[model samples]
Target: MTVTDQTAAVTTAPEIDSEQLRAVLEYYFDQDWTDGLPVMPVTESSLAAFLASTDRDPEEILFTIGHLNRSLSVRSAAINAALAGCKPEYFPVVLAAWEAIAKEPHPARGIWQSTTGTAPFLLVNGPVRTELEINSAGNIFGSGFRANATIGRAIRLGCINVFGLHPHKLDQATQGNPSKYTAVIGENEEQSPWPSFAVEHGYAEGDSVATMFVIRSVVHIEARHTMVPEQLALDFVNTITRSGALIHEYTSTLLVLVPEHAELFANAGWSKDDLRTFIFDNATRPRAELAAVGKDALSNRTRWRLPSDHPDSTPDTASTTDEPDTVRLLSHPSSVQIVVAGADNAGVSAVVEIFTLNPPREIPFSSSRIG
Candidate 1:
């Protein structure tokens, strides 16, 4: 069981009852050890229960966060999960999400410290979603769902405690969005016309999995009049075109569509690949437009350098009169991730862009089983 210097012995955390909880909460707040929310105290019983939910050893180190130089142990994860108000049954999903976070291509420290105020956007798939009662419908991205809220918060708390990406100190996000607190959504697979996100990502049909991505912004779209496939896809591409171009070597984008909106494509017999191809082809702007926005000579400057073959590697120097120089928004068709979620709101969708960097490489989207 390899561990980092920050690793603590597997000892029982101090207990705090309701009577003494407020004072402790105030103490943590005064120390700036919280995400501005009152946390559930990680008592001995809760910690034990969380640890019991997983089969791994409590002292076993899952991954060493490269940027932070911190080793995350199973015990530490369970402690934070208990603090985040997750049920014992939710522990597997929490651990799987952490594994996905560890597998990301970008370093965790850089992402949490970025000025864009990025945070992990989690998407759960398979029967575990229904078993945990995760929200995939109206106000799913908003409040009032425990499975959605705390599970996401657990990951943030783990980053703060185990990995030391504390907000306002190490985790500096200028004007962070509401998703920073919690951004977990389940695919409405039961109602979806297509396969589950897990299947598309190479998992078994019923396998429980969690997909994680470091998202900078989620652009919401409402195409109420899009009754046809082209209309709906064009609506998405229009929004993508208007968004800030952060084309990097690996630009992966997420399109979360409600079942109603997905139905339009299903009716047209279009596949997910078709949707990705359509968006990749149409989500473009003239080179002149990019130049007008001061992006003509922009280059990716991240540590994981992109190849020279990247479409945007060269300066967009097409002649102003040469057939309107066009630049595609997505690097490739596969870069577009299509997940059907939400209920009742037929035309509602969102485009979650990975944390944009100078060289355009953030954490690659990674998924792991919740087993």
Candidate 2:
């Protein structure tokens, strides 16, 4: 069967058993199914084992996902993750990630199942990073930990197997970012003096879970102690805004301010809102000026193309706001979301901002204590 793309072929999910799993694997092999490795088969027993790892009821409706125009059962997902080789302990984080992506505005269905080459990234917060042995330091996005490796693949498999999301069709990604095969997570907030992702999102600390979404490249914003708040913010705005933060409707930044860098902002009385406002005002660029940097995508005839290739979307805050002059420090505060993270070194801290509108939402990585 020629599956044109993810949205092109829609099929009802059949009961997945050991037999069907083998068949699918066989078909995959026949079709040369691969992303640098052979995918494991999604068997019923394997899925059951993953479900057994979680504390939630197997029947629990984690999310009525709308990505592929169909809802997913936890059973199906467990099976898919199991096939991807995610440990049973990774279940809770996966569950939370699905829920987060399923949030109406998050557009899990569109990006998850689309041919946009969009890949879901899991950003871990709270103290569970260490407990789960999630790597947030050097080579965090590379190989080594099973949690970081398989968790992302399992979700991708679910989007493929359950929702029928496929590459090159529904996912018309221009370059198909590396986040597709790699996972993104960091150290827990308990390791630092600042609040973790969950705490920032109004949840308690020490919760274990993951937040997933589509993302572009991640930018590292460094601020050594030599720079104060003004200088640090200035450095961050210049650094991140240069990475195509101008056109998307909503771009959530994962600000990994090393504690030292964070303290500069803290000392300057820079609240999150303050930083957002500053970035919004300064990140702007003149329309005439933006087109010079291969930003023809934001030109008058192509502006709408940003949100929907219609050429009506607003240009980057910098271009729209600073039309007449070139004092463009930056523009559009809404484009920025700041979060504290990183090792506590004496000299410098960093602000790692993931560029693009497909970044994950700002909810901290904490499971709701209600359950």
Candidate 3:
């Protein structure tokens, strides 16, 4: 459908002086449209610039929160992008991130409504990383880069303005983390020992892609004392299988390796696959350890039980022999996603724990090619 026809039902804002930034900010704040921060005025020229960057029809539906019956259009996304202070050239990456989220099997249930305080963690790959100046080095997750900050903010703003997922209302995060505001980084493909994450996922090496992961927490791993790959891998495994972090057997983790750490593994002739296998093989905890965190009963009832005449029988039932003494943290080796990023100076890495409230199923990793 055309932009004019599709946006007919969209509520129009009252005319405000585009030149008066203070008045525009106040207007949006009063309407509960801002994310507790100053937002750029959504001017006609700015919106037009954002729209011109993408070939998609302005009213094309990007995704819908099925339960709320709220659909986000390309035009609405552009509006949020403008409000988030994104450059017009960054619109395609924003749309691609949303497209990746929409491709998930159950975005509304699995992502938007989770009380675990999960937020979209975006990874930009390919030449667009350099084109937009998305930071892949030196405090990559920290503040500085406009493209990284605004692109992520655009997604959060859409969740608030378009879907009404306001905190203490629809978004019932117990304790949201810093990443809830913005979390995006580019893959340091230039300094990496392997191909870009997009290429590994079957996209062409030249293709720019945006990948989305709904994460609950990020734990930093420091291994400054060791040059051994096994030692670093053990540190990562320890972080991954920590008592507080291991909430499910099918939990997935994104291991973001700094250039220095990546080099340590590469020097040892270890491929990404080898590192993944090592992590999967060693990141296990004894079933008895669950009792230390008061999760034994829950684990037994949900995962170690047998099928009976109960109507709501879970499919994760295990046979007597299938129930091993030690429980694996991840479902498979591939669950430990490896990506190289950050400056070459640090021996630091980060383990991003995926949202796994609904477990015993494959976690959908979503990626879309950037325009």
TM-score of each: 0.86, 0.71, 0.88
In candidate 1, list every pair of residues with a backbone clash: 300-358, 300-359, 301-358, 301-359
Per-residue alpha-carbon lDDT of model 3 for 1-371, expressed as tens digits?
A: 68886677454656655668677778899998878889888879879999999899998999988888899999999999999999999999999999998977556663666677888889999999999999998788899999999999999999999999888998888888788889999999999998889999899999999999888888889889998989999999999888877555456789999989998999999999999999989977765675556543334454432223344333331123366556666767878889999998878889998754345346447899999
Ranking by TM-score: 3, 1, 2
Model 3 gets an lDDT of 0.83
lDDT of the candidates, in the order given: 0.77, 0.58, 0.83
Off by over 4 Å in 3: 1-19, 297-319, 356-363
Q: Write the per-residue lDDT of candidate 1 for residues 9-103, one digit (tens) a residue.
A: 33344554656778888887786556779888667877998888878999988767675778888998888888788898998998999898878
Ranking by lDDT: 3, 1, 2
What lDDT does candidate 3 reach at residue 41? 80
* TM-score-best of 2 and 3: 3
- Show model 2 residue runs off by greater than 4 Å: 1-28, 31-36, 41-43, 55-67, 113-116, 222-225, 243-245, 249-252, 263-274, 291-334, 342-371
Write model 2 residue lDDT over 1-371, tens digit each, in one string: 56656435444544457686677777776754434456776566667778777677776665555535666667766876776777777777677777766653434436554443556667777666776777765455567778788877777766666665556655566676677775656643544445565666666665654555456556665445464566667776676556355444334455656566666666777777786777656654444454554443433542322432434544443434434444243224545655555456543444444333333234322233211
